[model samples]
Target: MTDHRYVCSSCGKTHEGLPTDWGFKLPDEVFDLSYLDKYRRTRSNTDLCSLDESRFFIRGLLSIPFTHREGEFAWGVWAEVSKATHDFYLENYSNEMAQGTKASGVLANTIPGFPEITGQALDIAFQNSKSRPFFSFPRSAEHELAADQRDGIGHNRHHQFLELCGHFDESEA
Candidate 1:
């Protein structure tokens, strides 16, 4: 098995290590008892484990919605970023907000010579509407075209998540 490490550049905090697994959680405001129970039951060692207050970094991102056949109505987004790079973004995020600068995902494509990291979304969101709405990952022209054409509320959307994560692996990281 391969070991994957995700670090936060801003706070110098390390998230998961080796054999990396990714997951997302609902914001505190949207919490529900039923979902919390499910989350508690399904939680495992492979889930995203963190030691610091930092939540996430930036590498690439993708969102997919489950189809009617797969589930009623649910969606997921995944982000992959190395520690240093993510730290930079987190700083930028704070600066941008504090200075009233416009928020943009352009950095997702501008990092040069950094290994591309990808994430697998194995968890379901409690409130899909509250999930991250945009992805900040660099994408190939082909992917952009396919994503635009696909209706984003079914199995097709889920496949796009897999496609984005499939672009690279631990060796690239």
Candidate 2:
């Protein structure tokens, strides 16, 4: 299998590598709890692995993609950023994010090429939400138009995360 790597443009830090084909093209949303749990554990310690202020930022980074927007807030893209990028965003945007300032400001500030990066993620997320990955919509019609766009954003997020880790896997999305 080929190896994959994801680099953080902000700090130029590289995250863990993975088998290029390990998860890509497998299947999205397999709900691999064991894998997630293991990753969670590994990720928790990452904060301490970098800048002192970055610990909480790492957790927040992970939260970006894992958590879905409930009402007016959702940022599940951070989990995928290179550790350095993760820390950068947290360090810069923690205050804004906490205060609920320009929503994507944190990302725009921390992640390099964040404008396009976020836009890409937006496409996949819109598609995923329309598919109702975790929950079913009350009506198909209500979510009909935004389905592909939403999921498309989610797809981009997955791809970006994989890219950050230097891994190119998409099956787990």
Candidate 3:
């Protein structure tokens, strides 16, 4: 049995007991195999025997600043398309792309549902990004994914991507 000791932060009471006696839960850490357990369960049995062995990495990306502990919860909504979700969705991405006609000065006529999905993913990333430890973080950084925590997914590139997209002269190409 593992020895355990803990102190009550509010009551100033000191307690000592077995690790299991208190029944307190602990946060997960990086490099922990169990970190991705939640995502693993959602996968089909035919996919793979294990996550570490899988080509795609499992990430627990979160929108930062989820501090409204008493009010709204991030889980109340969704995280960006999980890396797995994004991978599983690869096939659908192209189909969502429109076949462009140069005559119209556009590549694809309409990306259709792609934009909506894209927006939702972006929103989730931004939410997690805002969940930072410091409030001084630049506003531009708000539209990003959380750090690549052991269990957290990192949505780092989205902002740079959005910036690039904003200035890209598709017509010149």
Candidate 4:
């Protein structure tokens, strides 16, 4: 991969590499709670979270291809799943045989520039134990993100995402 460098617009510090991946630290629902309520109602690790003994969430990659690049960019986002689905994932998390397991979920993070996607239906596909699950919009969905996933995005859009994530200033481009 090519290493790109920039001064962060948000932090004003030099950062190396073109950031190809961005992630949400927590699901929006859990994050919106008051400090005490958040601690009392949510249990979370880096990969999984449960809120109020009911809502279950899993972190996964929502990948978007680069129209002219060799690989893809990804957002490490969260998805809300049914208790049964979350339990199944926990059960098979360490098993390679769980590859190809599928479940349905709702997007739990509001993606930058795609705020409408937060509650959209998603199709989650489990890969091998070495990888996080992959989240995708339904093929028939009309959201712009679905279209981006299907058609890929150009460099301009990719740069826009970087700016949106506070990685760099567009004026510096």
Q: Which candidate has the highest lDDT of all? A: 4
Model 4: weakest 10-residue lDDT segment is 1-10
Regions more than 4 Å wrong, model 3: 1-55, 59-72, 76-173
Order candidates by lDDT, high to low.
Answer: 4, 1, 2, 3
lDDT (Cα, tens digit) per residue for candidate 4, span 17-110: 6767788889999988999998899999878899999999999999999997878889899999999988988889999988998999999999
The candidate with the higher lDDT, 3 or 4, is 4
Each candidate structure's count of clashing pairs: 6, 33, 13, 0
- Scanning candidate 1 in windows of ten residues, the lowest lDDT window is 121-130
Question: How many residue-pair clashes does candidate 3 contain?
Answer: 13
The alpha-carbon root-mean-square deviation between model 1 and the true structure, to one decimal in Å, is 16.3
Quote the lDDT for 82 in model 2: 43
Supply the global lDDT for candidate 1.
0.32
RMSD of each: 16.3, 16.0, 21.2, 3.9
Q: Model 2, range 106-161, lDDT digits (tens) per residue?
A: 12112322333321221111111112112111223133212422343343454454
| Best of the two (2, 4) by TM-score | 4
TM per candidate = 0.26, 0.22, 0.16, 0.88
Which has the greatest TM-score?
4
> Which has the better lDDT: candidate 1, or candidate 3?
1
